[model samples]
Target: MSQINKKWYQGMFSNEDWWAAWLGLFFFGLGLLSIWGLDAVGWIAKPKTWEFSNLIHDFSWSKLLKVSSKNYHHLHPLASLFITYFVFLILTSIGAYFQKLNVKKYIIGFTVIFFLTWLTWIIGHEAHLSAANATVKGHNYYQEYNLSWGLQLGGGASFILALIIGLIIGNFFKGFANKIKEAAKPEWFIKAAIVLLGIKLGIMSMKAMGFTKELALAGAAAAFVAYLLFWPIVYFIGRKYFGLNRDSAAVLSSGISICGVSASIATAGAIKAKPVIPIAVSTLILVFAMFELIVLPPLYTNLAPNQPIVNGAAMGMTVKTDGADAAAGAILDQLMISKHLKKTGEHWEEDWILSAAILTKVWIDIFIGIWSFILAYVWIKKVDRGNIKEKIPLSEIWFRLPKFVMAYILVWLIYLGIMYFFPDIIGAAKSGAHIAQGPYRKLLFMLTFLSIGIITDFSKLKGMGKLAILYAVALFAVIAPIAYFVAYLFHHGMMPPVVAK
Candidate 1:
């Protein structure tokens, strides 16, 4: 198989990575127009917290759904939702066409996925499942709903519901799963969402530059240390104990210890391993990532409720994929915030915990290119000395680099530029930025949860018993514990800011 050393702009138009950048940047640019007093993103629809009995008593579209911004409140809720659906369908279909996917299947699949996603999102926002019990600024959802009990999951309920619904189709309804398979691109969806998260980080910097900087630095430090510790240990175990060949061992090590599917593919390309090595390993990574996404959030929430930042950063290190890590972080963020609000009647702002996870994973994503380049050089020079005639090109780094991160950084810098250089328009900029980072980013996340579930098939692990065992043991026994320790070392005392009631 060919390594990823193609031309600099080879995948700019055809690759999902670049598509993520294009989609995210396009939305961000629209959001930037708000500084001119235009509300370009306000047409997007978002779910509102509502109770079932109240809605039954007086059913109204306004009770369940609303436009993202007040500027578009004049639009009917269903009209706003239709606009959201139509816009995304057109945008993603263009991406599918460029990427050479079957455009027909993609549109059909996306249509089904989109509405199903919204259905779960609306249901998950039912006050009994999602509303907080505590009064915040004189607004108490529990009292308003007259509920005796609640899950208080916040937006996490939607995420969980989406995953559950997707998994049901993926596992039980084989034919239907195949139909939507064309639109189930979890990595693409998550990468785009991460780009929108850049807006959140930018706004965060404006509010608490010191804390944001500390969190970013701590995440970087923890990620670096964990990477240093994770790879060699897993590689040694794969070789010494598992008796795997060098190629399989290296690919598996990168898959399990690094950033999952992308790391596996990069390492395979670096070592000139057969394409099947990474392909096989990626299946394992995706399946295992689903389990982590499902189990880790509530586990950490109950286990170390006080160590919010620590748990978040640890999740960033431990979870294998960007989608799973961010999803798990979002769930953890909601659970921790909701629990804390119930216990203390103080609301901690959202996204800080989730940011901890994404920042750490972003650092890891940034390093994968350098890591792969070094591995390629070492493999050619030290391990395969007979291949001296072949030279590893520097372009390999560029090819393997995660492209969405570039968009994320650019979006963040743009926000910062406006904050420092054009302070007067900050309010206008934030009006749109909030919608971009809030409802828009969350919609992408909801898609990611559903898509990830639709793609994962546990039965695929049947033949790879030994590899699966190694993955399970390494992930839980070694990686998880070490990752948590490194996260705690850097983020022990850090905490999310409390919102005044």
Candidate 2:
């Protein structure tokens, strides 16, 4: 039960990577039953915007929560929510048991995290915090609620609130944080969410096939160009200016310039660096990712309000971890769509901008295996030939490849198959696909935001002064601007589709 992949199928059941695929596809299968007139996925509960005074005067669960689809309108909101909790608890507990985590601790921790996450989600959906100032399809929550002013954050408010609450616990309440650490698996949650996002991408392709193709190609090009420029510059700076050794510099370079924690681990394994190196670098990555997640979305939304696609692609390259990048993209999508709807009376189709971010990140995620293989080969042959004993294995490529991306691609292909071959069932397929990509994907995102914050202990950066400084400087000054420019070059003039308001 080695966590590291030794055999081709070693981690199929025991790895979080593989579990992401399993859980995503399992739910996806349930959603697909809609094509046969089944409503398997509609039982998941979702929160709605609510006014505090109204709820206090006349309290009802219906005011706060509802099942995802009309087919399950007969179920009580609390019953639906309990079913959602029970289902996730059982499924994730099974994964934890296989992955060799403390099952009891995981269950308890997951329960606390789930309820806390839902509480934050519901609070963030307060009408004043989430309602847009504009009227869309004759519905204006702000006007309906008679609010004088509003933050108008949409779903981004929930994401931000979840992070803040988790951060407070992680930083201030260390004992509680340690208790729940076993279930704070942000990467796993986000990967599963990415798999669910395939449904969104598939639906998008059905609507705008040509634009989807262009966006995918442009994302690939931008990722390639960024890799060429990012690693070398960061490596040179780490080695020359920061006075780090070859292994430290290389690991740090990949962590900062490529994907975050995964790249650090892969690069460290490639060069046979001490495990402590990637662990330390991973701490840096998680902490900084929180900052980027919090700061980048609003900055880009206001700074380049008109360049929605470019901003999203830049977010993909700039944010280090998949969780943070996708979180930032979701926030950017909501903020930009809300801003445009308020100003121009046009609502941009949701998830298109977020797709831009995920598409670029997916390309980067896919290349890590190849990049690490080359690094392993170079380290063995050219860099440290005498020290290394074993030859680099070609199987490392498959080992390091993100399994969830394969699930994502497979889901997308299935949708395309339906679009081309079974066009008539498209309406029914969309009914379930929307729920999978909507409430189900969003719930995973909420978990990711909280878990990411809970795991990130900013106090770890206190002692690693030089490395932290280099990461901060390299990320903000060098990487951010360059990534944004590269994103703009590839994605300029591309815009998200507008919906009738």
RMSD of each: 1.4, 1.2
Query: CA lDDT of 416 in candidate 2?
Result: 91
Predicted structure with the largest lDDT when compared to the true one: 2
Residues 407-483 of candidate 2: C-alpha lDDT, one tens digit per residue = 99999999999999999999999999999999999999999888988988888889988999999999998899999
Residues forming the 10-long window of minimal summed lDDT in candidate 2: 1-10
Candidate 1 residue-wise lDDT, 281-340, digit = tens: 999999999899899999999999999999999999999989999989998999999888
- Candidate 1 residue 496 Cα shift, in angstroms, is 1.1
**Model 2 deviation from native, Cα RMSD in Å:** 1.2
TM-score of each: 0.98, 0.98
Q: How many clashing pairs per prediction, in order?
A: 0, 0
Cα error, residue 330 of model 2, in Å, equals: 1.2
Which residue pairs show collisions in model 2? none
- lDDT, candidates in the order shown: 0.92, 0.93
